[model samples]
Target chain A: MSIRDTLKDIVDNVEGALAAMIMAYDGIPIDEITVPQSGFDLQSLSVEYATVLKEIKRAAELVKAGAMEEVSITTNQTRVALRVLNEDLFTVLIMTRDGNFGKGRYLLRLKGYDLARELA
Target chain B: MSIRDTLKDIVDNVEGALAAMIMAYDGIPIDEITVPQSGFDLQSLSVEYATVLKEIKRAAELVKAGAMEEVSITTNQTRVALRVLNEDLFTVLIMTRDGNFGKGRYLLRLKGYDLARELA
Candidate 1:
């Protein structure tokens, strides 16, 4: 399947998932999927979240904490999870406030490797 | 109680919690405590984790996501949870690999307000 298809598969498979995107380190999305009913701007959200991944990686490197593996943010409205796919890419998943964080994180981590390999 | 005592209280009350700190946004720990057996560096870890919080906050602002409520990063070895206490400060908690993430997060969120109030 293509990158966009893969991203769509993730959103479709995970309940409560509103959007998914494969983005570069520079805050650019290679492909993305958003549930229209969710009313979220995937493009802007991806760009904003990319800044988060970049900064965390930078901080981890500076402190010798090794590479950042995964980051999950829980807000009152939604849950955002990020997993570093490789040096230049990462994936973002936005889920509903009641979404299953553990499941969302697990699925993302499991699929991240495959996604990276496919894109490579 | 004092900030140090407050931090220590968090570590003591939360099951599997290894360490806790109240730190500035610049990565300086105002008060912190680590379980002697945990052998984790609160100073460096706090500093490193501070970078994660700062970066996330910046990214959130850029994306118009409003103030970051909480951030959680889970690695094979530990789980780090961060909550913004104020404009210039935040809190960090470190737990074991098998730590209770849901509980840890809840406790941090609950105590964050009280801690912030006391510090203020």
Candidate 2:
């Protein structure tokens, strides 16, 4: 399907997932989908995280670890799973802390490939 | 147990575990241990990652996501798992790409408390 459909599929399928978005390493969002009343600014979070992810990708390369494929962050109130779509793009999922994080992770990987292909 | 002993314990118990360390958000290493032939500079990696971790913790707070409890990055050659012991300090486990990452994550949480206690 389309990029938005893929993003929507990820958010809709995962329990407690508030939003999903495709973002560039340079802090630009290509597209996003959020549930109504989700009540969180996921785009801002993604932009802030992109800066850190860029550094992380560089660090991984500097150490010869090769390309960073995934990075997940867990907090007391939420869980974020980010999967690299390619060198310049990535997908992020935002879920509640008590959400089905494992399932969210699984969906990110499953749909991340779909989103990547659509982008390509 | 001594902090060094606990750090060493984490590295020893997990397959493909190359190094472990306790570090502050400010980038100072509290304690660390590494295998003799790890052939990787884990210290530099940790130091570089600390900056990103600090930013992540802040972003989580800014989003009202609460404290950032853990972060994991996977690359082609290595996996790095970090667990926050407290606001200022966190534990890091570095393993080869094929390492037992689940075990490393568990040990970081299990022994992270021990190290936190030692520090407290």
The number of the candidate with the highest DockQ is: 2
lDDT of 2 at A69: 94
Give TM-score, chain B, model 2. Answer: 0.94
Quote each prediction's TM-score: 0.85, 0.93
DockQ of 2: 0.80
Per-model chain B TM-scores are 0.92, 0.94
lDDT of 2 at A80: 88
The DockQ values of the predictions, listed in order, are: 0.52, 0.80
Q: Give candidate 1 regions above 4 Å deviation.
A: B13-16, B37-41
Tens digits of per-residue lDDT for model 2, A84-120: 9997899889888888988988988888778878889
Best by TM-score: 2
TM-score of chain A of each: 0.93, 0.94
Worst 10-residue lDDT window, candidate 1 chain A: A58-67
lDDT by residue (tens digit), candidate 2, B16-63 = 999998898888888889899888776677678898798787777776
For A1-120, candidate 1 gives per-residue lDDT tens digits of 777888888888888999888899887888888888887777778877887777777765654545578888866678899998888888999988788777888889888878999988
